[model samples]
Each structure stands twice: as C-alpha cells, then as structure tokens.
Target chain A: MSSHSTRRGVASVMTSSTYRPASAAEARFLAEYDASAYATPLVTVDPVIVTLRDEQLAVLLVKREEHPFLGSWGLPGGFIDIRNDADPEACAVRKLKEKAAFVSPYLEQVKTVGGRERDPRGWSLTVLFFALIAEDDVPPIDKRLAKWFPLSALPDAMAFDHRALIDCAIRRIRAKAEYTALPAHLLPQRFTLSKMQRVFELVLQRRLTAGAFRRRIEPLVEPIADCFETASHRPAQVYRLRPDSGSLIFEQPLKGARRK
Target chain B: MSSHSTRRGVASVMTSSTYRPASAAEARFLAEYDASAYATPLVTVDPVIVTLRDEQLAVLLVKREEHPFLGSWGLPGGFIDIRNDADPEACAVRKLKEKAAFVSPYLEQVKTVGGRERDPRGWSLTVLFFALIAEDDVPPIDKRLAKWFPLSALPDAMAFDHRALIDCAIRRIRAKAEYTALPAHLLPQRFTLSKMQRVFELVLQRRLTAGAFRRRIEPLVEPIADCFETASHRPAQVYRLRPDSGSLIFEQPLKGARRK
Candidate 1:
C-alpha cells in the first residue's frame, strides 16, 4: 500500500520548519493577545428533553420571543451563566430549571454545534445536551409558549439550529439504547414489562417481537414483587433494572451474519 | 419522587421573572460586550494518535518549548485557526500534518473537554480528537521535539490537561472496540488474522481466544489471496475487511450474563 515508512523521533518532528516553536517576540504577541480583536461567539447551552407522550416520542420546545425566528418553537434552553455554573452540564441543568421549570432524571452532553450561520445574533456556539424524563414525571408547561412536539413530525422552522440538535439527540438515544440502560430513564420507578416494551418501541421507532425482546433483556432486568393489574387485563409482572447492571450492551450480530 | 407538576407553556416561562429574555436595551448591551469584560478562555484542539509499536500501545506527544511545562511532553496540538479551518476536526488534521508529517487513516471527533483553569494561559476550552494509524504508515518526524511514549507508562509531566485527555481517548477507544469494528482502523489495508488480533488485544488490554475471535470476525472480514510463509512457521492466511461491513456492532452480552 501507499504508506510512509519513516520512523523519525519526536525531536525531528518538533524542530521542523512547519512545527517550530514561537519566537520570543511571537510568544509575547500571543501572551499579550487581545481576545477582543475579533468578535467572540457567545456560548450557550441547549437541551432536548425527550419523553413518551400519548404513546408517541416527544420533545419539549419553547417559543423564541426575540428576532431571528421569533415566535418559532425551539428546544428549551438559554445562555449559560458562566459565573454561576461550573461546566456545560451544570449550565444545562440550571437552564432547564429556569426556563422549563423541569428536571430530567437522565442528562448527558450529546455534542457541540457551531458555525454554518446557526444564529443571526452574530457568531454563536451552543453546547447541546439530551435529557430523558418519564412521561408521568413531565410537569405542565409553566409558560403558554412551551409545548411538546412529536419527534417524527417537527415544525417547519425552529429557532437557530435547534432542529439539528433534536435530531442528533434522537439518533444518539436510539444508538445508546441498543447497548446502554438509557431506556430505563424514560420509564417510571415502577413499570410493567408491557409498558416498558411500548416505551422501547416508541424510542426506537420500530416494533419488536415481545418474545425476542424478553429473551434479549432477561438478564438485564429483575422482576420486582409488585405487579400491575388492569380492569380488562390480567396481572402483569413488574420489573426494575438490576441494581448491579450498569450499561449492559447486548451485541446482536450483523444481518448478513444471521444466516450462519 | 419529588417532581414538578406545573403545566405552564413557553410564554409563561419566558415572561417569568426567572427566565426573562434580553430586552432591547439589554440586547444592545450584550452586543457591545467586550471580551475583556470577563476572562474569555482560549479555545484549542488536541489530537491523540494511537498506534501499536513493538507489541505495546503508544501515543504521539511533543515537548513544549514555552514556559508552562517547558521540556515536558504533551499531545501535539495548537490553538485553532478558526478562520482557515471550518471546524475543530479540520484543525486537528491540519495540526497533525504540521506537527508530525503524519496522516491517519481514521479520525473521529471523540469529545470536547473544557474547564475554567484547564490552561495556564487563562481560562481555556479544548476540543479533543483521537486518530488511529498503522505502525508501518508512521512518517519520520520532521522536528526533534516529537516522540512516541508507551500509553501504560507516560512521562510524569505533561502540559495542561494533556494526561487526562489521553486517558479519555483510551477509554473511548477501548469501549468502542467492544461493540464497533473500530480496530480495523489500526491495521494496514492487508493484514493477517494474527496481526489483526494483536491490534485488538493491545487496544482492549485483554487477550482474546483465537477461535472465539475468528468466529466473531468471520463475517466481518473476507479472506484474501495473499499469505505469509516462513521456514520456521507455516503459511498464515491474510484477510481484509469487507466493504459492506461499515461499523458492524456485534452484541456480546455482559459478563454477568455469560455464565448463564
């Protein structure tokens, strides 16, 4: 193959013309560099709150009140308080409580999105986070402009790059669910196996054979003493994730290999 | 447990005293906000080049020539040229070529790490990337400042949070290798099964049985016509990754379930 075979040491790489260290004058210039020379983008934190509502996968969104897609729906988020919050995650938690008056049981830093004219308010960088809350735990919107939209059918336009952020969160959650206990975050403390199966189906956007799913998750969960009985249906077993299990990844072979 | 029950919408949240939007006057003030108003952290990108050398996992690092940890080894990286590069990934590829005269076959945006005091040059944010290169493809270092250090035994002193960055990359690569075919990136275009298995063992820090590994990868790779033979050893078969197997994730059950 076309591969370089030179086995030079670090000294040679560091002293080369392209990778040379800064001169004394250049070092001074960098040390005294005025950050205000160019407009620095405002860094913000945005979160996609995902939940199961009316048997549909939904996301929490808020209406933008200012210019640049004003009155359009967007993820519930705000500018991070750099002074008060310790990190981007802290900022996400604070913003969610302040703007949505909600707290998510599971929160994770998904990714960061910047550039591509994401915002009209000069240059901007946004750290995106995803939070999964149980449907029963979703509090009523404290404001008139916030609402839950189906993930599969979002509005035509959203504030900034909120649409892309939501899509990223959905894909990440689905991929993570395949291996992690992330779906547990979307279930109540006590849930029936059927209830959980429905949540899984909603999040994954596909139907799963109950027998296959149970076989797949048999070791991942433990049956509790409690049971849920409906008026029209018989008592179903209740289950909770095994306390010892921390992200149990079940590897299913590729489709092509299934023939074997 | 203690969950909020309010059903307010966006208007209520936005208009609330705690979550008010920036008013016209406040907007004007923010528009004119100067970088000197607060300590704005410098943003930089650092890359971790992981490879196998002499049957040991190693990473590329360079000695810092400046005052902060001068003469200490650190990941080869530099401040982002945002104007020239579209994103952090582009900046990482550029830095690698300049610093080591090396181009990786696979480069992925692993994660971003930032904190107030992460850098001695005031507050700083760093976007970290991990790249995988075959040992034979490593080019000669153009400068004398770069070197490869064993991952298990790095130097005592490193600049900034370089040590933590390296640890993060290792964990991510190891975890990813468990479910994804990322180990393929560490091997040459054409390699023997034994060579491929060794790369996996180095990254995962574990020994996998040859029969088990071969069965697991049977569908992932296809046999090639080439073979390597020596007087002391029989001809070893060669193989290559199948073109259709992109990011094949095999479901290996958790260890606790393996007993069953």
Candidate 2:
C-alpha cells in the first residue's frame, strides 16, 4: 500500500508549493485527469458568526428554503465560487461579505467537520470558522428569516450538524478567553470593568473572582478619563484595549472560582 | 442569498444532528438526489506524522509513484474510502495503519487547507492532522522510498502544497511545546530531564535556560528513582508523565532565553 494508491492526485511540484510543470509527463496527467470519474465530496466553509445580543452570546442563523433541510436553521455559509475564491480564507472572506455589512477583527478557523454519515448528499466536509462581530454592525439580511439565537437557547431543528459546529466554535472562543483578551472584542470601545467582567462570564459561562479578574485584566486594558455612571456604585472609570495590544496572551488561565 | 442557495444540501435535520425525515418532501429529495450531476471537489485527509531523529525533529515522507507528483516526496496520506471511513479521523487512522506499524496517542486535527487552484486536477481540499509517534515504534514498510527528513531541511520537491502543510504542523507543535508535555511523546518513557530539554529545544528551534525549563516541567513529570547515567555529570533521575495528568498545561510558556 504505497502513498500513490491512496489519493486522487492534486498537482505537480518543484522547488516549492507553487504549482510548476515538473515535466511533460505531469502536464499530461493533469490534462487527462477525469475528476468526474470518481465520487467527489461536497465541500463547504461554514462560519459560526458570534456577537453579544442583549447581554448574552448569540450566533446568527438562517432558515433554509430549499430541499434537504427546508426551514431548518443553519450557519451562514456556502461553497467556493471557484471562479472567485482564491483560497479557503478568500472564500471565508467572501462568505462574510455576503452575510452582513460589518467586518470583525477576529475571524479564525476552528476545525473541519467531516464524515460519510454526517451528510446525506454523499460524503461531505465543512471547514468551521469563528468570527466575532459587533451586534449593531449587522443589519437584517433581507427577508430570509434570519435570527440570533442565544448560546444557551439554540434551536432544536438545526441543519446538517451545524449545532455541533457551533458548540466547537464556543469551545474555541472560551479557550481563547481563558488566556487572551478575546472577549474584549465583544464589548464597546470604552466599557466599565463590571461590564467587561460580565462579558467574560457570559462567554465562559462561569463567575470569576473580582480581584483576580481585575489583576489579570489590568495589564491588558488602560483606563480612560471619562467615567461610566454606575447604577449603585460610584461612577466607574472606563477602559479600552491597550494601544497596539493585539490578542494579548496572559500568563495564566483565569480560574473562575474565587480564592479563599 | 439564503444558506440553501449557498450549498449543495447535505441532509435533513430534526431535534438533533442525526438525519431524520423532517417532512415527506425532504425524504423525496434525498431519494431523487443525483450526486454525479455536479462537479464536486476532491477531499482527502493528510496526517503530519512527527517524531525525533538524531536530536532533531523529523517528519516521515514517501516518494510518489503516480502522475501528479511522480517522484516527488509527499506526506503519507490519501483519499477517504467513503464506504469504510465513518469520519475523517477514521480515514487518518486507516492511513496510519497502511504506512507503518505504530499507534500514536496524540492524533489531532490541525486545520483545513482548501482552494480551487491548489490542485490542478480540480477544486481540492485536505484536512491536516498532527500525529506524534515514537520513531522506534515504526518499522520499515514494504520498501517504497520512504525516508525521514529533519524539520530544518525538507525536500525542495514536494507534492501538492505539502511543504506549507509541514510548516503549519511544526508551528503547532512548537506552540504546544511552550506550555505542554507534548514533546515528551518524542522521548522514551523513562527518560532524563536533560533529554526532555533537548527535545523541546529541537521542536522549538531555540535554546532554553535549564533552570527555568526544569521549574516549568517539574509538576508534569514524576521521578522514578531510576537514574540515567550521563557522560560528564552524575547520573540524572529518570522521569515520566504524572500518572493522573493526561496532558499537562503549565501556567506560563517556557521563555527559552537565559536570565542574568
């Protein structure tokens, strides 16, 4: 069982990854390759678009109109144009462009979901992406029955294992929240520490000790002069992500439990 | 556009990810679906099998025998037998079973690499996996020009975009090495701390301060009291991963630089 017997060939190679005609033989092989001869899988890129909605984490979903999972909710995603998409990232960018008007500072790949039984349309694979966008940036996507479901209240009638994909995305974002300033992206420009703590708690689904949370977040944020009036306590100082602090990695994971 | 228009539908959904006939129309659509009508892309799973050789990190590659790559080196992987492979992980495991004789405890999906132009045959995508196996555990397969190349010096003639894939795998391994006992899998069970330090350095491509390295690793490993004789220094105690510790994640990354 050699490696050659294992694959439907992709391309020729030379001094690098860029495709170059290695020889006349390889060129002939590409010309003669019958992609239709074999059973190829349907591939797609689905983004789990995340945002803060009414003090809770929500993901955007659209109701399908056609066959297979008609009326079932799905993440906003689709196939590569082939004529337009240069690569997966380009396809991801294009998918974002199609969904809403705003751009997110964080759009990262989570993982690939694939299997034979996962999709009824034959073997299928989907690359899952985690995108964090502001809630106000997205206008209603024309009358396609789009809605935001809170993380704790996802719909039961989900399409094509997309529920699992959203779960995977939440786990990834939570992991990032443990050691980086990822949750800050979900907040406004100048927010109170109390609001920031609530956002972290919302994403992580746990409460953090106020003292430890402040200590860990102090280096990542800088206080502003303007204060946000608090309901009960005195006016709290506002803070923003430090200038040039891109995805700041903290020294430790935030242990949400309070210390003795 | 709606999500239904974005994809070639996978399947019908219900109260869960499992496929079920949500409506009579959905069942009818599945029965009449024609997979051969469209130009679907080729999807494959490639594992970056990694280990240590001669005090340097190495990856196993096989020279291709077929047309697209011909004689160029490739990561030992192939297409999924949709009939047999229940999921992508199973496909990766089957590829490992075909290559050599070893089972790695750590087999993880890194990311998905996809594009239309990447593979000259047609639109192609591969799910990249990171597999860590001990070098000694692998015996030679039926001789087909299989060889191990150190990470620093890979073949210039690589098949597809495998060179980029290899680089991505290395970056992942190095990131884990900073805060985990991942590189320990590259070492023998009852190895010395000195050997562990070397393995980390090999994977990270940087020198580490011995004291700081030991301080970070102490909680992860338990001394067995068996000593490994050194050439110059007194015999060092052998250590293994803590019994209850599955994958030890340290509080901070190992700063490789020495202190004043």
Candidate 3:
C-alpha cells in the first residue's frame, strides 16, 4: 500500500487516484475543525413500494404515528439510522423491512426533495426511492399500519410532498416502459407474453399492438421449453426475461395505438 | 378557506389535500418533540458546471482552501445555507455563483451521493447536479481559484467520489442527447447546424451521419431569416432552437455513421 492509503479522506472510494498525505498545517486545521459546528440538515430516506393491487398500479403507504401529521398517510420511510445504516439506499432498505416487512425488492432512486419548510422540525431533505414487488409476491400485512393505494385514487390527506413524489415515480416508470423491459419486474418470474404485455399496458396506462410489442420484446425474453410443452396445448406461450433484459434499451419507443 | 388552512405541516406544500388540524393530544407530543434530538447527517449540494473549453467538453473544478483534501480540485459546490436556500437546486445555483461567478446556467439534479465513510468528519450526504453553460457565453474567471479540465484528461489528484459523480453526469447528458434536443444548450442561443453537430460529437465522442442528423434536428430548430441577408448567398444556414425544443424528444436515437 502507498503512504497515503493509510490516510482516510475524500478520494478513498474512487479508483485511479494518487492521494497525498496532509501537511502539518493541514493537520492543525483538522484538529480545530468541528463536524458539528454547523447545523446539519435533517436527512431521511423514503421508499415508495409499488405493486399491482387488484390489477391497478398502487403504492404502499404507512399510517403516520408522529406529531407532524398524526394519522396521516405517508410513504414508508423516516430518518436514516446513522448508527446502522451506511447510506441513503441502505436506510431505504431498512425502512422497507421495518415499516412494511418487505424484503429484497427491486429498488431504484427516483428523485431527491429538500427544503427548509418541507418538514416542520427544520430544514430537511429526503431521497425518494421507488421499489417494485411482483403483484403475487406481496406479503401479508396489517391494514391498520400500512396499505396499498392506486396511483389514481390516493387518500384525501397525505404527509409531506408525497403526492408529488409518487407522481414523479409513476412518470419515470411510464417513460422507461416505452423502451425498456422495466414492467417485467411487476410480474411472476415465468409468465405468458400476454401477461407481460398487460403489465406494460397497466403501468403505461395505454393499449399496445401485439405485433409492435412482440417486435420490441423478442430480444429481451426467451421461451421456456418446459412451459412450451404445456403452453403448446394452450394458447399463450410462456417466457422468462433474458439475463441481461433488466438493463436492455431499445433505440425506439413502443409506439402507442392511434386515437380512436 | 378551510379550518385547517392555517396549519403548517407536512401537507403544506403539496396541492389538493384535505388537511385536518392536529388533535389536542398531538399538540402535546409536538411540544416535547425535540428537533435536534437526533444527530442529523451532514448535507451538501454540488453543481458540476460543464462547458466547451478550447473545443473540448470540460467541467469546472475549484481549488479547496480548507483542511480535508486541502488545495485539491473539486466541483464548484458547497453546503446549503439553510437560512437562504429554499431547496437543493437553489443551493446548487448559489454555489455556482459563489464559487465560479456563474449565474443561472441550465442546472439539473443528476444524482445523490451519501455514506458514513465518504467524508472523514461523519456520516454525510450530497446531492449532485450538472449545469450547462454555452461555450460563447462562458464568463472570465481567476485561474487560481478555479480551472476547467477536459473530460478525457482530468487532473491526477482530486477530491471525494468526484470521478464517479462526473462520470454519472456525463452519462446522463449522453443518454439524453440520443433522443432529445439537449445538445442545443451547449451552444449559444443561435448557431449554425455544423456547430451544433460538432457540439454533439464532442459530447458523445462519436461521428453522426450528416443526412440523419439534419432529419432529426430540423423540427427542433428554425432557420433565421435575418441571417439570410448574407446566408442566402452562402451555402450553410444559421438557426435558433424552437420555443419548446428544450423538452422535445424524438421517437428514436440519432443514428451514428456505420463503421467502415
């Protein structure tokens, strides 16, 4: 290891950098520097867990038990536990497990909302993350603590800027669905092509021609030979996503049907 | 106005919600709720100011004057002054102005970086943003305080996870350039088609077919009739972005010329 490797500083995480040891003057400044000298912003992580509830695209929300908005519905999240959580994403994962009892869902950061007046406590910021759980994979939960609400019909009262947060998440999903196999995360590991198309339509809230969708989806999925034996007797063929389909990107969007 | 209209809480900023006033029991809880009871994580805002310097795409970096990584290069950003900045974007804009003398460049949040070990002080979080300044509109600056480095060859020594931050920002810009009119922001309000193409090539690091590029860009730009006074007698034409071109997205990616 190099001499500067022992000294922990900013360039530690990034590769391809030669860090130089601090000089004596810098060490004196560091001794005087206080981490808590300034008022730090209240940072939190919010995970908007999403799944299909009764064929409708819905997001999970928890009942607030705190003073800011007691009894109000809010996204499943709270302040990051600095003692255990290493990063915002780690905090989001822990929140998902603690508040909703969900585990290992496909989560992606969507946006960050920060300001002085967002939370009544003080200047605050929250990283917004959206998690997708297959409709059939949703575990049992107590309705009084948390419940799923369709994107179209949320409760009359919500806490913080959650309404905007959910709207942006849905917008991101819709945009990705046009050119990527993102909607596959909302279905069973093995599903019919028709079901995959339906999930895409549900998330995108539009009708797609089969020929067009198939042309776009063919490269992203593969037919299961075992399912083919049974599906051959049936109508719809069953398929699973290709290993790299999760990151697939098409050059063009799946064109929607013309207006009636 | 509703009876609860005066209540300032979580739902204050979001529109379309029936917010009920807190109950007497909740008010008691708020009285004892300490805003600073928990250790708040250190939060900051970073703006990666990008421009075309000497015919190459470059990002502005400042010389650190403080202890950690003292005298090292970093992005043009800093902590959000909670007393003044209303949101993270506002803080990013302020940092751009304070550090680089840049005012109101095209700013957009690209990502957020946070962890306990990223900073030596304590658990910290930072929102990452990238701003685009037109090559012709770049203001003069003091080299001692800040300097621009081409993306291909950055300084050997840097601060924090800035390399990853910059890579992510450039990836976002390249991905958007494929289908949207994002490259226009890298040039002056008015430019020739060739100059626009050059900017796109410099950003994407690839050559595009002239015929294909013009077809995709035509609807997003308008030829200047005034310039026709002399351009009518010339081979090339000058154009300006359309009013709504900033958000314009094509159905397909710009086609790059096939490799020989």
Candidate 4:
C-alpha cells in the first residue's frame, strides 16, 4: 500500500503538515491506490447562452474550425483555468467574456457532463452553464467562428456532447420558464406586455391566447406606468419586473382561465 | 500536436456515431494540439440518501474514519465506475444500494460539485444524487460507522464540502416539492392523505392546512372508494397515486383568484 489515504476522518493517518493527514488505517487502506494509475481528466466549461431576438428565443453558438465534425456550430466553451477564479460561475462568466465578449448576463449552473467516452480525447467533465441575455443587446458575434442560431433551427454536427448539453439546457429553460421569471431575463429592461408574451410563446413553442397570457402575468409584473407609443393602432403600456422577487413565482400555478 | 482534432459541428454532435466527417482544413486546425498534455480528471458520484424517520427528515451519513475532517459525518458517496454502467444515474443508484444497503427510492440528479480544493485528494468532480426512502424501510444503519442525522441538526464537522452539498440538496428538494410530486416518494406505495401531507410538512418545515393540502392533492390521487378505515374520530378517505400520471402536474391558475 502507498500509505496515502484520501479518505477523511479515519484517525490513524493524521500527520503534522499543511495538508490534512488521514488516519493510519485510512492511509493504509488507500495506500494501495495511485491517482497516477488512471488517466488525468480534463475539466471544461460549456455555456448555454440564451437570448430573445425579435421576440423569438435564440442561443449563441460558434462554428467549429477543427476536426471531428468540422464546420458545425455549437455553444462557445473551453477549458477552465483553475487559478483564475474561485467560483465556477465566475469562471463561466469570465470565459464567456473572453470567448464571446458577453458580460453581466443572468447566468446559473446547469449540470455537468462526464461520460467516460463522451469526449474522444480523454475522460473529461464539462460544467454546463446557462446564461440569459436580451437578443438585441448581444454584442456582434465576436469570434468570426461563432454565430447566433434560433432555438428552432440549430445546425447539425455539434462538437463533443455539446448537442446533448444544448438539449438539456433548452429543456431546463422551457420547464423553468413555466415556474420562474427566467424568461424575463431574455427580454429588455423595459418591454410591452405583448413583447413579453411573445418570448414565452417562442420558448414554449405554442401560442398563448393574448388575453389569457396577459391575465396570467398581471400579478407577476407591476405596470411601469410608462407609455411606449407604438406606430400601430394603440399605445402599449410598458412595465418592469418587480424588484427583489426571487425565482419562487414559477412554483405558483399560472393564474387565469384556460383559453379554449 | 496530436493529429486527432475532436471539435466539430455543434448540432451534429447530437446524432449518434454515423454522422458526416470533418473537412481536411478543420482537421488540420484541431490536430495541432497535444491532447495528451493534460491529465484526465477524476469523476466521482456522491449519493445524498434522504429518508423520513421518526417524523423527521434525515440524511444517511458516514463518519469519516480518516484525515481531512476525521470523525466528521457526511453523505454516502464513492467514485463512479464508468465500465459498469453507461448512465451516471445508474452508477449512483448502484453505489447507494451497495454502500448504503438501500434501494429504489426517489432518485434524481441534484447538481455537480466541482471547485478546486473541494477535495483534498486532488482535482475531483462529484455528481450528487438525492434519494428519498421511507424511514422504516431503511436497512439497519451500517455498523461500519454511518449515522442518520436530521436535516435540522447537521453535524458540526463533515468531509469535503458535504455541508454545502446537503444544504443545496435540501433547497432543491424544497423547491421541487412545491411544484412536483417528489414527496410521494417518501411515503409507502399506498398511503392516506394525512400521511402524504405529513411528508410534505416535514420536508417543507411548515404546517399546511389539511383542507388546502387535500384540495391541492385531490386531482393527483386515485380515490379508492370504501378503502378508508379511520383510526380515530372521522375515518379519512385513503388514496393511492395513479401509476401512469407523471410526477409533475401543471396547474393553470383559477379564474378570479389572487395571482400571488
């Protein structure tokens, strides 16, 4: 046995060093193993950047210039720099800015993908991140290699497990939209009721009756009381999301009569 | 530079192995890097086994017998065996069964914990699984030195960021219970409405009005006529969950009800 036990709390292996020591019994038990015996795995981060463009839901993707499935588009992602940031979410934000010039978006941890053979290079675990941005505010695609793709028409031939990653992200977003204020993150700071409804419609892939949708969202939003004059027949009322409300609203059932 | 370039089209990655090949230019760009330079990462699966015992929600934990936080208690977890099961969820279930001697509870992927230094062993990533088992059905506590601790009174010392892991799992369960039928997993196959309600109350840490809770749950259960034999006072009706119904129920709000 190598006498190096990673197991914690066993009393025998404790030693006097900066590295906490394991108990002697634990050290002896783990000594038979060697971390070097297995292949060193790579850690990467994948971002699911979502935006509402022209009332339609979209995801940001990059065109691949490398092999495997060359010329395919996918979410922008890369390896994590361990020394840079203490938090994975922070690393995700930093990477998005560096790779795609996106900043300060509504970002949350999605999940991690770690199938041994999912990646051809070696065993790797990619931390998945979901970010929401207004469609219009997205900076011009910086990486000539990357482009914005509508959620409905994603290009084929994504890299690695990026396709599965995107699928999970989209499903989560749609499911969450039903319960939380996540979709609001995709809209502008100030928007009309109809505009907000359109974002939901596009994400849900179904048309919500205008009257029903408005009634459903009435309590969730407080009217900003500002009028955004439209070129159409009537002026639309503008509204902003209520402040300090966390993601709990989605848990409440949608209010209003179902549109027949 | 290794000639094996893995980066390819984004969407095409979703398709099984028989897709198109990368172009020569794309291959050349990706092939330049030495994929072997980096070491493969360590991926582990940690099971957050939760059960309701003595009318309290508890988590099954093992006392660390080695270094790190020797003597501290934490969730039962182990390294994932990729060769045994293609799915991570399966591996998680396996670990719980083999290590904890428990089977077939409510299991779901909670989240992945991957921060540098989270584990003193080395760079490690853990896929957390949460399972809810009926307290009485749980096998005798593993004599090898594991214990069940109530959610309200977690031990002061725990191994490898498990305190945070448990906290995250609790929040996830609480949020999930509000919208999904997760609490049903904690009860027997056939249970009374009061039993079901108690499970919810314990997990939520709040008392729910019996009438309100029953109204909310009525649609979810299949009423068994003449099946109730009340123990005291009024014999409450007993119901069993409809096997075919999905765990989630989308409740559109009622007309004229307060939205919030």
Best by TM-score: 3
- State the local distance difference test value for candidate 3: 0.75
lDDT of 2 by residue, A1-260 (tens): 10111222322310123566679988777666665555555667888889999878999887776666777888777665444556667777676556543243457899988776566666677888988776655545544456788987999878888998999999899988887878888887878888889999988888998888898888888998766657756878889889877657776678787645
Query: Model 1, residue A225: what's the lDDT?
Result: 74
For model 1, the stretches where C-alpha displacement exceeds 4 angstroms are A1-41, A251-260, B1-40, B226-232, B251-260
What does each candidate score in C-alpha RMSD? 12.1, 6.8, 7.5, 7.6
Q: Which candidate leads in DockQ?
A: 2
User: If the candidates were sorted by their TM-score against the true structure, best first, what order would they fall in?
Assistant: 3, 2, 4, 1
Best by lDDT: 3
- In angstroms, the error of model 2 at A96 is 5.0
Interface RMS for model 4 = 9.0
Q: State the lDDT of candidate 3 residue by residue for A133-228, as single tens digits.
A: 897788886676788899888998788778888888888888878767788889889888888888889998889988888888889899987664
C-alpha positional error of residue A98 in candidate 2 after TM-score superposition, expressed in Å: 4.9
TM-score for chain A in each prediction? 0.78, 0.84, 0.86, 0.77
Worst 10 residues of 3 chain B by lDDT: B1-10
Q: Which ten residues in a row have the lowest lDDT in candidate 3 chain A?
A: A1-10
Better of 1 and 4 by DockQ: 4
Put down candidate 4 lDDT per residue, B173-229, tens digits, no spaces. Answer: 887777677777788767888888888888877777777677777777887888885
lDDT of 1 by residue, A147-239 (tens): 789877899977777888998988998988766657778898777777877777777767767776776677778888756556446878788
Residue B9, model 2, lDDT: 35
In order, the B-chain TM-scores come to 0.79, 0.85, 0.87, 0.78
For residues B1-260, write the lDDT of model 1, one tens digit per residue.
10111112211221113222336654554345332233333456789998888888789998876555566788878765434455567767777777667664467766767655566443356777888887778777756868899887899868778999999998898988877768778788788888888788777777777777776677788888755634337887788899988777654521211222
Model 4 misplaced stretches (Cα beyond 4 Å): A1-37, A248-251, A255-260, B1-36, B39-41, B83-85, B250-260
